[model samples]
Target: MHRCLKIPEILLTIFQNFPSTTYFLEAKCLVSLACTCRDFHAPALDLLWYTLEDLVPLLRIMPDDLVRGKLDPSFWRQWSFSRPLVPSGFERFDYYAPRVKVLTRLSISIDSLTLQDLLQLSSLAKLTDLRMILPDDDMTLPDVQALDHDGVAVLPALLDLHVVSSKLANCTALIQCLHRCTLESINLTLQNPPSGRSLGELFMVLSQSACRASLQSLMISAHDELSHSDEDIVYSTVLAPLLLLRSLYIVVIDNSNWPGLDGKSLQQMVLAWPRLCYLHLYTFELGTTHHSLVTLEGLLPLAAHCPNLCTINLGLHASFKMTESLPGRGVINRNVKLLDFGHSTIDIDAVPHVAGFLSDVFPCANIISTWDEDEFEEDEEDEEIAMSTAWDEVISLHPVFVIARHQERFAY
Candidate 1:
């Protein structure tokens, strides 16, 4: 054996250098290395169990005599155990749980797991990223008792939590799993707009979270459109708690009614999340009624508050709002690069006005319209094509105006 291979760091580097496109094939090699000798065992095992596709594989690691796996073909490849789970059965489970850093598609059957099962499974002290796609049926974590007397969380070191669910109850239950950890990011996709009560409970949990001050990114998107446009389901007061997350840099909320979010609310958002770099509030295909009360002028507050903001996407009514009347040639946020006006109304004649306004506010921004070539081929509405052309013209004229602004500055 080469002397260099004896160095732990060098060996780990060589092992990581292998192609990861096929993780199962890579795992085959790692299993071989684990069997080769003691030096390769620990590192190979660490890399092997670093990222898990689901908890099923980890549960399978336990002795077959202690826990047997049964596949139920009636439902979605659901796994069940032959015998009741006990604390003594988790010896091997505890061994490999700490090595896992990322866990995805983590769905536990209510019938398969009990309160005791969850307590034994919560030993993943080092888990940093967890993603769950929950079923609408009775999936929850309230039964799992809180941290022990010494004060430790279920996933104590969790940094990112991403969950996609059709029901809000599942999301509420999952949030209860978090105890004392300060999370960095959370992404949620709901198939339907949540009821007022469920939304309130969800926000209440987040507002009281230990990570409220530490959270950096938040995205809440709904897949289904509203049945009726009466009022905004997302009220200002319901979302007010998010303002407490002062360190937030990225916020994206899509396809949800925010009738209450007017120009005043927009200003409050800019002031609350001063470090915002990417802000996307889109309500495409929902019509102008769902658009925020903010006009094109509301963008100035973003320029004044979030100087480092790079990307901006909004559902504001775009028109001439006298943006040229700045104190000193307007506050230009040079960091902004992409400006997306998703299905907001803009007339062809107003292209130059919009372009000029953007050039002054976001001097380096490029206009982005969400429509694509495929939509055009599908014979989309004439209004969509007209708006797309208007945005394209804005894209062209923005850079010219930017150059003219620079020339004016040079002249001064």
Candidate 2:
């Protein structure tokens, strides 16, 4: 690199040209740039410290006494603090700590995180987004009580948190800590959730968060089905107060028992949370098989009111005969360009009508639904083709239906 290229602005522009996933070179390039000159130091350093994937960089800055654990200094990058160790120097958190404001993603085993480690992570002053993962061998139950101790609590300003394969007790502590932190989003994935009774208590804790009003996105998923007889708790009655919420995802992998909404209640949600831009609901139960649980009639309130809604994913009871339409509601959503029905099942009988209705509302949008080769019944395949033809026909000024070709990338 030339001296002129070391101008902070020029360097930033050049570095930013690399994709955000340019993780392969982000650390090396930014660190090298920071060492070049005093002028390039702050900008390059800012970029380098903006995301701390691990504690190795910080380990390099620590006083020798702090790391008395006979481990190699370089070994800290892959080290796990399983033993009861509290290095008393959080106040000594380095100069670059404040620059970390985005996803402070740390891949670690929950069992390996001692009180000291958890407290250390909580003390990331500027952390807004964080994701913690449990390694494959971490079968030990988590200690939730310690997570809630005043000695180690989350500070306000942290917004997004995601915990995968963690215990319900751990999740409870994290949610209860919301009162301390002004969090907006929470995502949890449990391979095995607790009993329905305990699960309800966990949800109640979240619904009653001190910062519930500030919450905007909440995603609770599980590999196993979470069946609740009291489905009302998962609906608008509990979440309606989050008027600022923009995205909501409730997915139960291959489980049909997840809670759902009817036309009236769904309408109420659309009215209550006008800011909702994304709403995804997944379940194995086929609404198309049973016509009453969910109906196309629900689309009335959505198309009429939700102007900011850009994406929707809900199972619908498709019918061959189109439902009655609103006579005078001319409202059209401009921002909603994607409609996903990944969890929705299309009725073989009503493919054309469903296509026509979807096209009528989102004329320029792309539609996504479940697509499987082996599971495709002959009747459904022909209907799907017919639906696509209907969609393409209405997309253009002319009646000619042209299929769009799309190439999807599978890997990062």
Candidate 3:
């Protein structure tokens, strides 16, 4: 009888030592073990709760009927799933209130009311990191604005906040909110056109904040409808205030209308960002006319200003004539360690010219090109396979760097 009891104990010990049992998997097994005997019940319950705390989304998505599931009644008895799990609203606070003390990082999809509830979750006062992803629609603006309003006063411990929205008005509000916090870094998507108030409001907020001095990184995207004049104003007002910015990424979405920046204005802005080290730019369908493609010419002068720039990414749409005028390899800074170029067609013959230009500009940097045939086939399978292969190849080749692609690359 004693040997029989020892056999079960040895089996349980072996299961606990299994290398493949991850935290989540182990927790599930513990639930089963707890149901078998009173001796395993208390310890298993403790392990289950500890593991579930690390997995917050499971709590958010746990179904109401989970309590009635066929698995085990005791497991459900200890677990709390009565509170609502919607991304926003009062129930979110009630559900998280007990567990917030242990949560150091949280990521959630944003809706209009979600931001409001997050603001009221005072338990998150100890949270060090928060990431909110907005839907790709009009709601993005209001959601971001709500966070912007409460972000300053509520999140004193927050070190990073990433907001993706589709309105310039929300971007303006986000900037204003950052002014109130001592944030170390931010990633934002500004997907709307530069309207009158949004543009001025963003600049006004940045100019007033000491947060600009503390910010180390920034990522911004603008709608293609913004005029060259508007872009110039943005660079001068909003970007100029970020005097201490180290890493920068600017993506200009290609609306049917091709928007290009003025060469002289770009030159001034590039020269002003002295602390900038990494720069990425994505431009789509800017016109073939003199006014449209002149922005590409500004690259030469822009490279000259950022002596410390170590990485550069450029995505553009251009005709052969515009490509020919592209300043050859010499304009690239020697300090640049990674160079990415996309959208320009490069045949075997043109590869050397492209490579030569890159070698001239950034001689010490590693050059990786995503060269594709000029003709694209309509086969969906081929496209899917090609994309999967391209992503895998890029990831394998460039581990620590990013590859920028034109907006058209995703358009069907």
Q: Highest lDDT, which number?
A: 1
lDDT of 1 by residue, 1-412 (tens): 7787777788788888887678779999989988898888888888888888678877787768765555442223545566778877788899889888766435544423345554554676666776666676766454524444535456767788877777777877777666466888888877766555566677678777887888899887777866444364545666687777788999987655455666777788888998899998766453423445677777878887898799988777677744436522467788888888766767567888888888878887778776553465434466667767787888899899889988998999
lDDT (Cα, 0-100) at 94 in candidate 2: 51
What ranges in model 1 sit over 4 Å off? Answer: 1-114, 138-152, 193-198, 222-234, 286-291, 323-329, 347-349, 371-386
1 against 3, candidate with superior lDDT:
1
Clashing pairs in 2: none
lDDT of each: 0.72, 0.55, 0.48
Better of 1 and 2 by TM-score: 1
List TM-scores for all candidates, in order: 0.70, 0.58, 0.52
lDDT of 3 by residue, 57-133 (tens): 44444455432323221121223444554544445445534433355566655555334554564456666566655
What is the per-residue lDDT of model 2 for residues 42-160, given as tens digits with 9 covering 90 to 100?
88777777777555566555555555333322122244343354655544565767765553544343555555565676666666766666443434332555555555555445777
Model 1 whole-model lDDT (C-alpha atoms): 0.72
User: How does candidate 2 score on lDDT?
Assistant: 0.55
Return the clash pairs for model 3, or none.
329-357, 329-360, 329-361, 332-361
For model 2, the stretches where C-alpha displacement exceeds 4 angstroms are 1-107, 112-122, 135-153, 166-170, 192-202, 221-255, 285-292, 320-331, 343-349, 371-373, 376-412
